[model samples]
Target: MTEGDSPMSSIFAAMAPVPERTIADATTLDAAIRAADTPFVVRGLVLDWPLVQAGLKSAQAARDYLAAKRKDVAFTVSVGEAGSNGRLFYDDAMAMNFRVGRGKLPDIFGHIASIENQPDAPPVYLASIDMDGFFTGLADENHVDLGDRDLLKSIWIGTRTRIAAHNDFPQNLACCAVGRRRFTVFPREQFRNLYLGPIDNTPAGRAVSMVDFHDPDFQQHPRFGEALAHAQMVELEPGDAIYLPSLWWHHVEGLAPFNVLVNYWWRDTPRWLGQPQDALNHAIMSIRELPADERAYWRDMFDYYVFGDPELPRAHIPEGAQSVLGPLTADSAGRLRGFLLRQLSK
Candidate 1:
């Protein structure tokens, strides 16, 4: 992709720059990540990796390196038609514009390479494939050590494509393994202005902003301009990486014909803890349709029970009679799940 290929090129001067950190190695990287509460760029973070070296040589070399490392397993891939302009998103009727099917690494790479130089090429994306699951030793060979923390390490390979703004529950460290990428980010508070799409019926797993960053329809989504006011943009070259805190919204753009990114996503909380999104989904079903007065009452109740002072709930109740109001352990969590399931069944 060229300079004018992305909308960020035109509005680049207006957006705030994401902060940068100079991390020397994996240990320092881990420390920096633990300390970060916001997104920041890290230049040359993985410049010494052999995979980075192969990519710097050429896209073909990168492809060859991946093919040699990957296991002979078919992975799910998404392909957008030519007119979609590299956007893997929903159509006017809320149907996805892209087609998804399974393909092996080598065949997918070959197809991506075949249309690499075309001006109006279709977008082909191999997204969020678990590195260790599909590749024999690629994860160990091309990786940044983040201590012994349990992590979900995934790889994304694709041509020039636009991913709509979406937020993740886990903190992310995304490395530009090959080619180039530009990220347009918004804080979690910008949710009201982003004009998010349907949560249940989404193109990808996450709910994304409805606005098209390339050619934003201001008349339709006027508040998106406000979202841009709080937006920050960062462009990463090969071997560069960026860290994003949990719940921060990001719109990603693949700027090269054969771009690849490797990202690690992990939450700070215990794995046994319930997902917050599930609670939110249940709230929408149970609380959203209530009468205005009843809803307001529930809001206050939630504020007191869920978001209020932790100590306040147990302060008045006897220590022995606190039950679910007290501290939750793995056993308590399992009982709570069972109770909720029984209640739902009724």
Candidate 2:
């Protein structure tokens, strides 16, 4: 049989494994999040939630449930022509392939209600609306009690749609609240094989893979075959959830005519550590085009000074004299930031 026709167990057997763990309730979910270093599926984690109950009744019931909680707040929604077949991607010339506009929460819900059952309808997505900001009580009604007050809770509502493969900076808990959803995930090390798009100007907020998952042109993106070999697929039913570690690439597909997904994102890093993307951008600007030998030398330097044991580098130096290379407190981080600003000014 062809690879496409092979059983899922056979396909997954060929690739690296993604584990599945069952957590009985929300309390256990918090522990799982803290302990899990890899991506995992949590079966029926939110099955008892009221939102899931409403969704199980009917799509209309779910819509009404959301509408009742929405406080007339406006959020951005993405619209694409029906011709695109729900894939949000780029055209031949590499322009944004869809239109994004602002609309109210209730209005978007009405739009979903009007077209949900139609056999042919344009893709409409209320992508990544902050749930706590727009629907104030929604988090309280249905939520993951991770106990992190700063955790970001967001809502995704859309018609049948496919989001291109992309990575996020924070740890993600994507809960399928209303409809079935599919996720194809790849480990962070597969970055090169994914045929990623431009870093600076992205179709979505994050840089997405240029290689379309539905109909990848193997001739143009041959490495994508390698990526596919390593992919792990999961189908999440209503109330199922998946934990995606930071930097894991994922492609998402909404299987139903209308879908509502609730996601929580947070970082364990200290606030002073800042974003690693900034350092990556600086490295690209300063080091990417350097000679091979110089690049190798810098790589070794980074391995030793940055990724190596923090104590190893500063063990011999006096605490007061260690400067930027020593333990980083808020004051030291501020000084380092000032130093970087001065360097950039030149």
Identify the leading candidate in terms of lDDT.
1
Task: List the RMSD of every prediction in angstroms.
Answer: 1.7, 3.4
Which residue ranges in model 1 land beyond 4 Å of their true spot? Answer: 1-8
- Number of clashes in model 2? 0
Candidate 2 local lDDT, 39-61, one digit each (tens): 99987888878889999999888
Residues 27-58, candidate 1: write the lDDT tens digits.
Answer: 88888988888899999988878888999999
The TM-score of candidate 1 is 0.95
Name every residue pair that clashes in candidate 1.
none
TM per candidate comes to 0.95, 0.89
Worst ten in a row by lDDT for model 1: 1-10
